[model samples]
Every structure is written in C-alpha cells, then in structure tokens.
Target chain A: MIKFSINKAFFLQALNATKRAISSKNAIPILSSLKIEVNSQSITLTGSNGQISIENTISAKEENAGLLVTSSGAILLEANFFINIVSSLPDITLDFEEIDQHQVVLNSGKSEITLKGKDVEQYPRLQEVGTNNPLILETKLLKTIISETAFAASTQESRPILTGIHLVLTNHKEFKAVATDSHRMSQRKLTLDHSSDNFDVVIPSRSLREFAAVFTDDIESVEVFFSSSQILFRSEYISFYTRLLEGNYPDTDRLLVNNFETEVVFNTNALRYAMERAHLISNATQNGTVKLEVINNQVTAHVNSPEVGKVNEELDTESLSGNDLTISFNPTYLIEALKALKSETVTIRFISPIRPFTLIPSDDNENFIQLITPVRTN
Target chain B: MIKFSINKAFFLQALNATKRAISSKNAIPILSSLKIEVNSQSITLTGSNGQISIENTISAKEENAGLLVTSSGAILLEANFFINIVSSLPDITLDFEEIDQHQVVLNSGKSEITLKGKDVEQYPRLQEVGTNNPLILETKLLKTIISETAFAASTQESRPILTGIHLVLTNHKEFKAVATDSHRMSQRKLTLDHSSDNFDVVIPSRSLREFAAVFTDDIESVEVFFSSSQILFRSEYISFYTRLLEGNYPDTDRLLVNNFETEVVFNTNALRYAMERAHLISNATQNGTVKLEVINNQVTAHVNSPEVGKVNEELDTESLSGNDLTISFNPTYLIEALKALKSETVTIRFISPIRPFTLIPSDDNENFIQLITPVRTN
Candidate 1:
C-alpha cells in the first residue's frame, strides 16, 4: 500500500510534465494510464505512449512539494481522469492512499474520489538506454537546434525515416541536426568546446519536439545517452526517453549549394511579413504560388487568384545582385523556414527557376541553412 | 473614384466588428464581401451573412480615426481577404483608391494590394427596422439577460422557434426574457422605469448572443427597435440587425412552481464546485447521472461510473429542510444554471423524483428563476 500527501500545485506540475508522453489513443490500454510510484525519499510520475516515455520526480527535500509518506508502493491510474479530479479538488493539498485490490482513494477537503488503478507490473518496462559516456548538451542550445530543424521533417507515415531528425556528432567536437521532407530541408550545426563520444542517431521529430519543451529555465544542461535502439534525454528532475528510428537517414549534404546565379539580401521580418500577405491571397488560389521578381536591384512579390483577387507588393530587400530573375513557388514552405531561421537578416541564393534555393543568415551562413525545392510553373 | 486614407488599427477595429456578421459559408457570394461606403465626413462598413447584418461607422470627427476622404463612393470587397491585407500592412496608415471597373488598390508603405470588388449596387439592402418609438435598455442589463437565459435555447434546428429566446414587454413596464430547450428552461424578469410600446418577439438565440458580444465597455445603453420581421440593436457607432424568428413561443410561465416537497439553500460557489466534480465523473458514464442524497440535514453528491470509477463528495449546504430525499439528475444542466445565476446564495426547490426542479437566487427569487426537468431514472 502507498499513502502520501503533497501540495496540489507541485503535484500538478509533475503530472503536466509527464502528460506530454501520454496519448489517449494508445494501442495498449495500460499505456493511457500514468504510473505513480512512491518511496521514502521522493515520488515519481511516469507516462508512456509506447514510442516515448517521460518520468518526473519530486523529492521530499523540496520544501514546496510538502510530501509525507507513510508507506511506499506503485499504481497506474487513468491519466486524463485522474488529472481532472486533482485539478478540481477543493483544497490546496491532496491525500492519496492505496487500498485493497488495486483501488486508490484521494481526498481533498471534503471531497473524496475512489479510482480503480491497474497493477503497475502490467505496464511495459521503460526502455533502458545505457548511460555510459553520456554527451552533455546545453539546454538552450539543444532547444534551439530542435526548433530550427524538426519542423522540416515529414509528417506523413509513408516515409517513416524522413519523419525523424538526423543527429550526428563528428570528431567529438561538432554537433549537427538535420531534417527534411524532400521538398524542404533545415540544417543546424554547432561546435562543442569539449570532446565527447561520436555517435549518429535518428530521433523521431515528435520526440525531439517534446524533449525540447520539457526543459525549464532552471535546467542548465541535458545528459544524452544512446543505446542501439533507444535514446535518453536526462535532466535534473525529468527523464525523457524515446526509441530511435531504425533506418538510416538520407544523405542530404550534397544538396547544399554554394553557387548561385542571383542572390538577394533581405531583412527577415520585412520579407516574412510580405510573404505572409502573399500567402493570404495565394491560400485562396488553385495552385497556391507566390511569384517573386528581381529587377533593377528591386524585388516584388505577386499573388493572383482569379476567383478572389490578387496582391502585388514591393518586397523590402537590403540588396540584390547577379542576373535579374523571376521565380514562383509555394509560399508556405518558405514562410515556415523563415520562421524557424529567426534571423534579422538573411541571404537567399537562387540558381535556375527550377533549382532548389537556399536561405541562410547573412552573418552565420556556414552554420545554419534552409533549402526549398521550387515548383516548375510551366 | 472612391479614395480614402485611414489608420490601420482604426480600420481593423471596424473590420473586426463587421466581420462577426460575415460567415464564409454564406450561400450568397456577395454576402461574403464587406460593403464600404465613404462620404466626405464618415465611412460606414457593413457585412451580412443572410441571418444577421452589422454596420460600423467611423467618423472623421473621431480623433483616432484620422480619416481623410478625397472622394465619396461605395464598394464591396471580399471581407476576409481585405481584412488580412490591411492587417499585415507594413505601415500605420493605409491609402485606398478605386482604380477602374470593379478593382481597388490599397497602398501602405511599400506594400500594394489590388483586389477585385463586387458592385456595391448588387449588395443586399439592410432591413429597415423602424427606429421610431424605440425602447432604451441598459447595455449591461441586456447583456446580463442574455447570459442568464440564452444557453437553455435549443441548438438543434428541428424546432426552429424553440431556438429563439422569447422576449415580452408587458404593460409597458415588465420586461421578461425566457428560453427553453424542452429539457430545460431559464427565465429572467426586470421592471423598466420608463414605458415603451408593449410588444412580444422571439429573437434567435444566436443573434442575441452575437448582439451581446458586440458591446464594448464604452457602450452604456442600446436603443432597441422592433419591426414585424426584424429586430435592430443600435448603439452610438454600430447597428446590429437580425430577422426575428417566426411562429409563437411556447407558454412556460405555468412551469414555475411555488410549492415544493423539499428545499435546500446552498452557497452558490461551493455547490457549483461540487457539481462540477460530479459532472467530471458523470461525463464518462453512459447515462451521465449524478445522485444527490439529503438525509438528516446532510447532503452528499455521488457519481458512479462502472467503467471509470466513482466520486462521493459531502456538499457544503447552508440549510436543508422537508423530508429526506434522494434525487439523480444530469449534473451539466444544474452546473450551467448555477453559473448563470451568479448569485452568492441559492435555493433549490424539488417537487418529486420525476418532476422538474427550480433554482433561484435566495435574495431575489421572483426576478430570476431557472427550471430544469430532471431525468427519470427507474
């Protein structure tokens, strides 16, 4: 039997952290439940959705936790239902106790809730990723890398490998993260100060996104461990684990272009706003294309919808050079890539109208790049 | 030619207010467009979605408007598209000019948007609800009436008349608003100090909801005008019009009970929270029933879901009298009714197991009352 009382807000924080890994539409019935295990020193909450699992621990040493334990045990309760009960409790503190035969009682003020819990033994064991020689990554830097690349990953299930972010550590000093969906690709590279084990792994984009979100301001760094099939992101209070994609990521290094017939430099915000307006008009058109023209050192964007109307806007470009050219492509892809770049000034290089164009921050072009394949309008 | 220059934020405010009446799924193509009529002194924007129409005017006299009109004319442009263009413009001020046949050019800084405009002459005329003998109502009071009763109206369109809130002004002094969805009913009554023409009308619940939402904090009073087929809600700068629902509203006056077998008074907030928890549990059950037991002056609420779990909470009741009783009900209905009451203390009257119950504010029971028909559980 397990019996404990804890502060409501602290408990809720732990529950919310674990909830990111619990999906309601799980194939396994027990996977939809959250596992609560209590010990003398701390309390741990775990939630899993088969592909990923998150464990959050609150120790008794934390004063805000207000934790008191009479016995220690583990139980699994329906995640959403239990969350609702705790959220609506009338008091600031909650009392939890395990009764006979997989039943738990929760009390807060005058309200009492009795929930049927599943045996913790029935829950699938968390994947054990070996922790030896763990690579240390700055929490903020890792978050930036995930945000810059994960959105370019394929969401469609048909190409499962493209749905993962390809991560590589080369020469124990360089870190690279890349994601692509054939039409567009984003790559971010960072240099490390210290040496670590060199490894390459493909982590699902969803897991990377969730892992990045789990970081709080207090978590300075994350320790990453990679096994043959699983990867772990461990911080001070939370452990996020996900199964690695088994297939090899596609080779996209050759796709990066260093040559261009024309290049235009733009203030990122100005171009993004113009592209947004163009997108608003193109969204109503049949083909959803925004055409751009560079002439006499000036840039203009045009969107035409025969049924609705059209928009022609002179884009704010810092400078333009090389052969004047006109190109049309899907505006959504470029808009997303620009949002991820979050640069004040970016330079876009274009070859032919049909070739893929690349956008990189003007100050740091060598470290980050976004490439988009253009559509042939003929 | 129609031409004007105005502040973007001021223009967007007018667009947003008018956009409430424009639904994209409108059957009439022109109804999806907003009509802009500019005169030397003022600009009026109108949008209609067949069911309702809203017109907002911006006057040159308003300091924030900064409106300047070089010519006076009217045009109709796609509501959503035009709004998006103006919203994303790079500058604070926008210049609009009708260039040629059915085309308008809008310029803001370096961005220029050319849009196709429908002929203003083809736009439908606003319904003429006679403004003579208008009834004046406190905007805050009318808003209160809407919130207190509108939710009980039937959302299903099978019985069109039942989807309206029946409003009656009797003896030129007593004003009452009532709505019922057959399963439940809510009634609010107020006495007007000034007299107006006695009238009875049924306004569609959706229109009343929209009308209430249009009121900003600055609007203190609304002038109401009623015609045979349409009702108009007019404020200083906005005129809201909707067609009244045809057919007679059902008689619900007899449903209010003056006699009861059991009566329990409760602190409205405490009861509401308890019912909310019960609702959380009952929502997962097949029948969604919350049972209430009042025995020996103690009240306990119980919710049982065989598949999920159960909750038994001792309620905080002010006072309970009459014989012992056990009643099961759809907790959602009571929860909504209690929320609408917005009263510190409430008295709930029960007649029998199968009969309807009534909830009224303990302070002013006669002015407002909510009646809910209990579910019959054998």
Candidate 2:
C-alpha cells in the first residue's frame, strides 16, 4: 500500500513532464498506465510508450514539494484519467491513500475520487544506459543544435536511417550533429573542452525534438549516456530515455560543396519576406517552382502560375559577385533553412544552376552550414 | 478601369469581415469571388455563400481609411487569394489598377502582383431588406441574448424547426427569443422602448452565432429588418444578411413548469466547478450520467464509471427547502446551460426525478430561464 500528501501544483507539473512520453494508444494495456513509486524521501513518476520514457522525481527535501509519506510503495494508474482528476481537484494540497490491493483513494478538500490501480509488476522495466563516461553540454547549446539539424531529417519510414540525427564525437575533442533527407542537409560542429570515449550514434529525430522541448531554462546543463541500443539524457530532476536507431548513417562529408561560380549576399529578413510572398502562388501549383534571376548586380524572384496569375519582386540584396546566373528550386527548403540559420545576413554560394548550393552566416565561421539541391528546370 | 490607393491595415480588416461569409466550396463558380464596387465617395466589398452574406464599406471621409480613388468602377477577384496577397504585401499602402478588361495589377513597395479579374456583372445582386421601419437595439444586448438562447437549439437536422431560434415581436412591444432541442430549452424576454411591426420568424442558430461574432464593441447599436424569407442586421459600416428557416416552431409554453416539490439555491461559479469535475469521469462512460442527491439541505454530486472509477463532491449550496430528492442528468446539458446563464446565484426548482427542471437567476427578475430534462436511469 502507498499513502502520501503533496502540493497540488508541484505534483501536477511533474505529471505533465512525464505525460509527454505517454501515447494515447498503447499496444500493451499496461503501457497506458503511469508507474508511481514513493519512498520516505521522494516520489517518482514514470510514463513510457515503448519508444520513449520519461521519469520525474520530486524530493521531499525541497520545501515547495510539501511531500508527506505515511508508507513507501509503488502502483500504476491510468495516465490520462489520473491527470484530469488531479487537474480538477479543488484544494491546494491533495492526500492519496491505497486502502486495498488495486484500490486507491484521493481526497482534496471536499472532493474524493476512487480509482482502480494496475499492478506495478506488469510494467516493463526501464532500460539502463551506462553512465561510466558521460558527455556534458550546455542545455541551450543542445537545444540550438537540435533545432538547426532535426528539421532536415526525413519523415518517411522508407529510409528509416535518414529519420534520425547522426551525432559523432571525434578525437575526444570535436563533436558534430548532422541530418539530411537527400534533397537538403544541415550540419553543426562544435569543439569540446573535455570528452570521453569517441562514439557515434543515430537518435530518432522525433525523440530528440521531444527531449529538447522538455528542457527548461533552469536546467543549465545535461548529461548524456549511450548504450548499444539505448540513449539517455539526464538532468538534475528528470531522466529521458529513448531507443537508438540500429543503422549506419549516410556519409555526408563529400556532399558539401566548395567550388562556386555564383555568390550572393542578402539580408535574412528581407529575403524571407520575398520568399513567403512567392510561396503563396507557387504553393497552389502542381510541382510548383520559384525562380531567381541575377543580372549585373540586381536580383529578382518571381513565380508564375497560369491559372492563379504571377508575382515578382526585386530582392533586397546586400552584395553580389561572380558570374550572373538564374536558378530555380523548391522555395520551402530555402525558407526553412533561413529560419534555422537565425542570422542577420546570409551568404549563398552556387556552383551551377543544377548543382547543390550552400548557405552560411556571413558574420560567423563556417562551422555551421546548410546545403540545398536545386531543381532541374528545362 | 478601377484604380485606387488605400491603407493596407484598413483594407485588410474589411476583407476579413467580408471573408467570413465566403465558403471554400461553392455550387456557383462566381460565388467564390468577392465583388468590389468603388464610387467617388466609398468602396464596398461583398462576399456570399448562398446562405449568408456580409458586406463592409469604407468611406473616403474616414481619415484613417486613406482612400484615394483614381477612378470609379467595379470588378470581382477570387476572395481567398486576394486576401492572402494583400496580407503578404510589405508596405503600409497598396495601389490597385485595372490594366485590361479582365486583368488587374497591385503594387506595394517593391512587390508587384497581377491577377485575373472576373466580370462584376456575373455576381449575384445583394438582396435588399427595406429600411422603411427598423427595430434598433444595443449591440451588447443582442450579443447577450444570442449567447443566452442559441446553445439550446438542436444541432441535428432531422428536425429542421428545432435547429432555429424562434423570435417573436408581440403587439410591437414585447420581444422574446426561445430555442429547444426536445430535451432542453432556453428563453429570454425583453421590452422594446419604441414599437415597430409585429412579426414572427425563425432564424438558423448558426447564422445568428456568426453574425454575433462579427459585432465589435465599437458598434453601439444594430438596426434589424425582416423580409419574407431573409433578415438583415445592419450597422453604420457593416451589414449581415441570412436566410430564415421555413417551418413552424413547436410550441414550448407547456414545457415550462411553475411548481416544484424540491428547491435548491447555489452560487453559480461554485456549482459550475463541481459540475465540471463530475463531468470529467461521466464524460468517459457510454451514455454517461451524473447523479445529484439533496438530503437535509446538503447536496452531493457523483459520477460512477466502473471502468474509469468514480468521483463524488459535496456542493456548496446557498439555501435549500421543500423535499429531499435524487436526480440523474446528462452533465453536458447542465454545464452548457449554466454557462449561458452568466448569473451570480441560481435557483433550481425540480418537479420530480423524471420531470424537467427550471433554473432562474435568484437575484434578478425572471426574464431569463433555462430548463433541462432529466436522464432516466432505473
């Protein structure tokens, strides 16, 4: 039996964090339950959906937790139903007690709720990732890296390997993260002050995104551990675990372009607005395309759909050089790349009208770059 | 040629108001376009989807409109496309000009867009609602009345008459609006200061809800006019028109019960909170029912869902008299009825466990009342 009283607000927050990993539809009935274990000093809540699991612990030592435990035990309850009940409780503090096997009662003010609990033994045990050698990084830096590269990952299951972001640590000093969907690629590299064994792993893009969303500003840094088939991202009060994709990532080093016949510089905001307007028309056409033309020092972007009319705009370019060229490509790829760059000014280098192009921040080093393959418009 | 220059923000607002009536799919091709008529003094934009139509006019006399008409003419443009183009323009002001018989050009900053225009003569004429005698009421009052009675109307189409709210002006003095869906009913009555023609009509609940949404606080009063098959609500700068439902509304006067064996008074907000909590569990069950018991002047609300558990709460009642009783009902109906009441304290009078009950504001005159039928659970 388990019995405890805790602050409503504090418990609700913990439940929400763990709820992110709980999918509504569960292949295993017990997987839809949330496992809650209470000890003399703390309470832990765990929720899992097979692919990903989240666990949050609130320590009694923390003044705001307001935790009082009469006994120590573990139990499981329906995830969504329990959360809603807690959310609708009327008082500041709620008392929980397990009077019999598979029976639990909750009292908050004049409201009393009784729920059927599942057996804790029925839940799958959480996979353990070895923490012998952990990689430590700033939470904000990790969030930024995920945002910059994850969007390029393929969403289709046909190429399962491309649906994951590749992370590699080389020479125990350099770290890099890359994602690509054949048509576009994003790479981010950074130097580390301290590292352990060099390893390479592919984490599913969806799992990485979820991990980044759960990271709050108060979590200054996170520790990551990798096993053969599982990865864990751990903070002070939370642990996030996900299964690693079992496949080799494609070699993307040779895909980066160096030689260029045409180059242009543009204000990020100005170019984005023009692309958005052109997208309005191109988006309506079948296999729509937005074309860009460079003449002398002026550049113009235009989209023509016979049925919906046409739109043309003079781009606000910062500078231009090399041979003047005209190129047509999918506008959506460039728009998303620009948003991820988060820069004031961007530099674009093109090899040919048909070759892939590269975009980099004009004010920073080339450590971060994105590549987009142009469409062959004849 | 139709040519004009106007402030972008002012024009966008007008387009949005008119766009509310334009449906994505239209039986008549021309109905997908918005008609624009510009004279020397004003420009009117109209959009219709057969059932309802909305028109907004911008006058040159309004300083903020910044309307500078180069010429007076009329034309039609695809509603959604034109709205999106105007929204994406970069400058504060946009210039529009008709270059040919079926083509138009819009210039804003460095962006130029050309769109195909349709003949304005192909668009259906706006049905006129004679202004010979108009009944005027405060916009706020009309909004309140719509909210108070519209939710009780039936959403199902099998009974067409119940899907509309019956509005009647008796002897050109008393104004009453009532709606019922067989299981529940809401009625609101008021007196008009000045008299007009006595008439009765049934307006579709959906149209009134949409018309109410477009009314802003700036519109102090609305003038309403009724025709044989249509009704129009007109303000100084905007007009909304909708077709009336053709059917005889069922008489609901006999459904209102005046005597009861049990009476209970409760604070509206406190009871609503309890009901919401009870609804959480009852909502999960098939054909869920929430049961309320009154005994010795104390009330308890409970819901028992075998699979999801049960919740019981002691309600904070203001007063109780008469007899003890227990009743079961569909919580959704009561929840919605309470929301529409918007009262501080409500008095609930029950005739019996199986008979419908009435709720009225305990502190104010009985001008607004809502009745709910009980669910029979043996």
Q: Pick by TM-score: which candidate is best? A: 2
Candidate 2, TM-score vs. the true structure? 0.98
Once fitted onto the true fold, the runs of candidate 1 whose alpha carbons sit more than 4 angstroms away are none
Q: With candidate 2 superimposed using the best TM-score fit, by how many Å does residue B211's alpha carbon deviate from the native?
A: 1.2
Report the Cα lDDT for candidate 2: 0.90
Candidate 1's displacement at residue A112, Å, is 1.3
- The residue-by-residue lDDT of candidate 1 on A140-226, one tens digit each, is 988889999999999999999999999999999988999999999999998998899998999999999898777775799999999
The 10-residue segment with the lowest total lDDT in model 2 chain A: A280-289
i-RMS for every candidate: 1.5, 0.9
Model 2: CA > 4 A from native: none
Clashing pairs in 1: none
Please, what are the lDDT tens digits per residue for candidate 2 over residues B1-378? Answer: 888999999999999999989986899889989999999999999999998999899999999999999898999999999999999999999999988766888999999988888989999987888876899989999999999999999999999989999999998989999999999999998989999888899999999998887878789999999999999999999999999999899988888868899989989878887888889889877778899999888899989888878898999889898989999998888888888877799999999999999999887646898899999987
Give all candidates' CA lDDT scores.
0.91, 0.90
Q: Which residue pairs come into collision in candidate 2?
A: none
* Model 1: CAPRI class: medium
